[model samples]
Target: MSEVPQARRTCRRCVLPESPPDITMDSEGLCSVCLEAQSSKPQPEEELLESDFTRLLGKHRGKQKHDCLVMCSGGKDSTASLYYMRKRYHLNPLAFTFDHGFETEGALRNVHKAVEKLDVDFLFYRSTFMRDMFAKIVTSGSGAILCHLCSMWYMQVALDIAARYDIPLVIAGWTKGQSAHQGTPSNGAGQAGNREYASMSEATRRFLATLKQDPKYRDFPQSMEEVLKRARRRHKAIVLSPHWFLDTHPDEYVELIRRELDWEYPDLSYPAKSTNCSLNFLAMHLSLKHYGYTHYHVEQSKLIRANQQTREEALKDLEFNCPREFLASLAGRLGIELPE
Candidate 1:
């Protein structure tokens, strides 16, 4: 992908590319997001430690058939999380992966290999249930975010399975950028609580209202808040990610997984080094066009602010490269043409 889309100017201070209204650069080359963050008062931040994580894990370790259910995406962060759960923390985890028909072959392969090597019980669930919903978003020109909708659905899956299996913990691979509640005990409301997601969160909530009008999705929750609120009553699975507590540079874990579990990067992915589903290309396309940024930009921006990643590294990793032809092919899978 090009360093920056020619039409949009990027903030000099951060990696967020400008899109009017939502993100804009000032005369000084700083984007509105950076300015907003700068003007805000610094809150008392909590320091998390590996020992704290170990203590939390000890709360329910060996209490059930599986001490936790680790959501493995086969990406570096997630794969390494799976390895650490089994090897580092000495926890028996049920490895869970859900594919909505667009997951890459290499990503699935990585999950298979990691589970086998770790000797964890693996559950691979694949379905085309989401194809119709994605098709509607493309064909009908709905302003809904594909990723946001899928996140709700996927979280429901994670909750249901954990509750069914009576697992006490739900392990994800999220970094600090991915979860604001990281390191702190949370009641399960996630990224939706972040200021950066406010506008996009509203859009997704509107889309969910429309989704609920349909017979197939009439029971769908109207927002992330609704999803979590309902989940809290039925299950007590506290979600956690090892990366949240471990300050190890992501590069270190990537190398460790590759050397230990024979992990390999996928041949094709947007944002270098990621192994996300192929459908994410379309999700990101809609996100950038409608909201000026994707969730990765939001996450990477947080990393830059936190000093976990440099601005240059965030820009390089977040460089988007989905060509029109490739997007058309991905869209065609849902029997819809690419957006004009």
Candidate 2:
């Protein structure tokens, strides 16, 4: 019988393993990420008080047919955001969901149920506009981060939609991990600038730069920074997430959405219980193949640093739980076969 390979050791405080260049383990078995986080001085940050969120909502509410555009992914965080916009803040929100042909049925169902229950206008855009780009990433072996590229495309779409509808504020369900690194709390939503994300963002920017050389993708934004800059010049809209200000935990709101909006967790996900698109499994697999970890590891590590989630919980969620067959099926969709 073949000997089983030993599992790679991870940091004592976070889920990041000994991935070199970007991440490394020290003599104490703690990762460089953990050490840096430990030694860093806490900078003064403007606290995003709940009152501030309420005030922002008040400023935009009742100004137009739809006060805000809520990007609902049918996940717990986004569903809760939709619920709060309608029930808590009493704002007429236009719930928008974009499906790139890889969205899971569970997510779509969750969105349908939430909008029906909230009695809000819903916009579901399903297209294959991204399929060719996604296929290129796999076929050409360009180590481009799928989620980053997808976000660029979708963010541009969201900004255009907001402009078309005359919506002033666009809302997302991004947790603290996603936007906590913005220099100022006011620039929270859709911004990633934390130390942990530095290396990954650099990789994404480099990959996107190469992607822009293609005639088809020539118009694609060179980086997320470019995306935000262009959006600002064209149509100024403040993007915000309620999770940044609200003290509610995922468990707290997951249960609430389950009971109130009839939301059910997806049957399977790479990161255990996440409601990510089906293509995420392929993205995670490829990320782990090239880099030692996926962006989920970065996100979870941030949560661990914030004490929002224990290291053990993050490790559990970050475990490779998806079956090999599922990965093969997803890869087949892109006309690629996984090597044994």
Per-model lDDT: 0.80, 0.79
TM match of model 1 to true structure: 0.91
TM-score of each: 0.91, 0.91
- Extract clashing residue pairs from model 2: none
Tens digits of per-residue lDDT, candidate 1, 1-340, equal 3123467777887777776656778999998888888888865567788999999999999999999999988999989999999999999999999899999999999999999888999998887888888888877766577877777767778888999999999999987546423212122355434655656666665666677778887886666556666888999889888988888888899899999889999998877888889999888887777666777887778778767789988888876777878888888998888867
Q: For candidate 2, which ten residues in a row score worst on lDDT? A: 180-189
Residue 34, model 2, lDDT: 88
- Provide the global lDDT of candidate 1 against the true structure: 0.80
> Could you give the C-alpha RMSD of every candidate to the true structure, in order shown?
3.3, 3.7
**C-alpha positional error of residue 28 in candidate 2 after TM-score superposition, expressed in Å:** 1.4
